[model samples]
Target: MTAAAVACTGLAYAFGDTRAVDGLDLTVAEGEVFGLLGPNGAGKTTAIRCITTLLPVPSGMVAVFGQDAAGDRMAVRRLLGYVPQQLSADQNLTGRENVALFARVFDVPRRERAERVAQALGAVDLTDAADRLAGTYSGGMVRRLELAQALVSAPRLLILDEPTIGLDPIARTSVWEHITAVREATGMTVLVTTHYMDEADQYCDRVALMHRGRIRALGTPTELRKGLGTRRGAAPTDPLPSLEDVFRDVAGSGLDDSSGDFRDVRSTRRTAQRVG
Candidate 1:
């Protein structure tokens, strides 16, 4: 049997007195698109950080592609690509330059860097704009540029954190299309975090709903929706429950308007109050 692309057993992380990720266990199979769905402050990012080796994980806790993430950080990093929540591309540099930098950072062979950079940009449909400065690109294009940067190293596993945040519906769909296309072309494992339930239903092969630093539910989108049967007195003949409904049932209410970025607590609170 093939080894899982990612595995976490009894993984935990704390920030000061607050436990951000508490005793989490998860497995992402190779060549699958998996999503960690949660509201703000649910520790999805924290868990992702640990998996990507951005934070120290306890011994025997986390592994990437069968290599211990905590013990074999360099090896794991070699096989992994991460597109963080915040913007990463340097505005002053052209898109090609940004990706070329990542190619160097990932230690792509000196002779192959240019070809790798070109392939990465082409994969994300950014070849035409490769010569343009990233600051001039639209939000959607910026996200795609970041995707290209992540792809420059030819990683086996890709990790995305709220990758389409703050984009319009169309732009969000476009970004995901490129991601799905890349995954299909390379057969890479994708682990993404998002509060957008619709995106999870549309793209993920399996999803884990996290809440309060733990997984509240886990299953395919269809299975999760099936677990919620006519909660609001809707007849069986009515439309099936959506992933959003499943989230509300599993994680309770108040998740509808929540952002996935837990770091922006104050801004989220203000937005919630304004909406309320």
Candidate 2:
């Protein structure tokens, strides 16, 4: 069998007195789109950071394509591409330039840089805007530019943390379209974290619902909703459960009441309306 694209076993991380990720275990298969869903402070970002080599992997607990992230940092980095929660492109740089910079950072040979840059831009449908300053692009376009930058390295695994955090429905859909398209073309594995349960239901081959620094549940969207069985105090005539229902069943009550939690609810509602 092919080795897992990403594997985390007994992984844990902490900041001072706070434990961010605790004994987390997950496996994402090659060429699969996997969603990591959780509320604020659920250790989703901490896990992503460890998988992407941003933060130190506690001992040898995290591995990318069988290369230990802590022991083989450079080898692991070569096979991974990451787009963080925040925007990474410089406002002064043109879309092409931003992607070109990543090509250099990824150590693409000089002979192949130009073609690789063009292919990356074309993959995300950014070729038309290649010469335009990233500052002038729409929010969705900027996200696409970031996607192109990540693609320049031709990574086997793409790690995205809240890639569509602040965009409107249309923009969010647009960003995902390019992502799905590229995945279909290249068969790259995607590991993404999002609060939008609706998106996870639609795009993810499998999902893990994380809470309190651990994976509370893991399965396909259909399997999870089915596992929910029935809602509390609901009439027999009530509609079947949605992924939202599954989320609420598993992680809703455990979620901390915070501004970020409120924002995530608002975002999920918007995405639901769009998907509906």
Candidate 3:
């Protein structure tokens, strides 16, 4: 296996008295897709923030491409591309304009910025919309634009947080296909956090399932499926249960509710809040 592109050891975070990410240890191999699978408020975002230098890791270690996140944040940032959970680009700007902005932030050479912007938009199949205002794009198209902006820096490590959220089935599928194509073409290390079991099963080389601020399980989709004994009682005539079944079985039945609730489990000084 290739060396680790990103590594976190005993990483923890908090809000108020709650522990949002409790001693999380993770590793992502070079050029591989590593998926972080979890329900809402499972600290997936918190962990991503720490790794991407959005939040401080007060008591643990996070490294990107052998650069320490705590001590060498600028160096780490230079090697990473981030697609935040929330929309990040200006609504008034054109798709190409957004890419250009990111290219500049990432310090792509002035002479090459235009070419880089074009390449990024092309990768996400947004070349046709490059000159169009971003506010005119659909949710999926906006997502593609966000992805293009992230890639404009040509980062080696790409971090996507709930990338396909709120997208329709067709749009989600298209986004996943584009993600797969991008990874295959660039050999970039990808770390994605998603609530979708199918996405984790289909696209992730390895997955870590998190629950209530801790990692509950880690394995490839097939390995995890087999480990759950889903195939044990299946006959030649019987079809296997989906990965969602394994996820529910291993991660617990508590996640089965559709309450649409959000939890604030951080241990920071801020008061905890919830959304529904």
Candidate 4:
């Protein structure tokens, strides 16, 4: 049955004095590929850290699989798997060994760990290179190995932050292929943050566009495109505008500005309500 995999309300984080994620709210449903899309330095990573409980929210609620992240972090972690933007594997270890290490740490049953490791590797199509040292593999294969490690625990909620960044086009496609295949085979809930609009549109059941620490839009790809309104009628309408165009039109080429105008508005409302 589908469930709320992650929920965050009024989440805020700051670095020094600059607010990173300001009063952010988000929700991801189970058995769906939910994508978080934003420009660079738009608090996407910060928001992810809060939901994954890597960083404290300081001013909001973060839950995973119905468990309060702050109060039940261990329980929350058990049901969640994270693939960070950076690779985190031992260079010396073989692909199979890296997955094995994670399985051991997560305490996957010994008898099942081997089979699970093999299955995960196979899912990523890395079984052929399973025994090769991770350092020997290409960037694409390294990503696949990391994905295999994430899947070893059979987690209910998978969080991926820029899982295919910096890869060549062919490698990027390979990674996406494996991700779609694995998610389909396992029926897992995935929360992905991606800068690639096409990938997000292709794979995600729904997407949320974040700008300057707030959700600017949330809908299916088709809905977001339609919300862009029709271009000046030149013959038949184009039917759908590209997400890139929608982003530009919505933000007016200032998506990079982090002035926190939205946060200030939210704070003013809160204060007025409190006074009233």
Top candidate (lDDT):
1
Candidate 3: worst 10 consecutive residues by lDDT?
A: 267-276
Q: What lDDT does the true structure give each of the candidates?
A: 0.87, 0.85, 0.82, 0.81
Q: What tens-digit string does per-residue lDDT give for candidate 1 at 1-276?
A: 778999999888877767778889999999999999987778888899899999899533898888998888999999999998767889899999999999999999999999999999999899999999988988888888999999999999999988887778988999999999999989999999988889999999999999877898999998888677655666778778999988887777645333334455654444233222
What global local distance difference test value does model 2 have?
0.85
Best by the TM-score measure: 1
Q: How many Å off is the CA of 49 in candidate 3?
A: 0.2
Off by over 4 Å in 1: 230-236, 254-276
* Global Cα lDDT for candidate 1: 0.87
Give me the displacement of residue 217 in model 3, in angstroms: 0.8
Per-residue lDDT of candidate 4, residues 1-276 (tens digit): 544888898998888777888899998988899999876656888898888888876898898878998898888888977888766767799999999999998789998999999998998999999998987888788887888889999998888888887677888889889888878888889999887888888899999988787889899987888777555333344556788777676556654554444553454344233222
TM-score of 1: 0.91
* TM-score to true structure, per model: 0.91, 0.90, 0.89, 0.88
Local error of candidate 1 at residue 29 (angstroms): 0.5
Candidate 1, RMSD to the unseen true structure: 4.0
Score residue 15 of candidate 2 by CA lDDT.
70
Which stretches in model 2 have alpha-carbon errors above 4 Å?
Answer: 230-238, 257-276
- Give residue 272's error in model 2 in angstroms: 18
The collision pairs in model 2 are: none
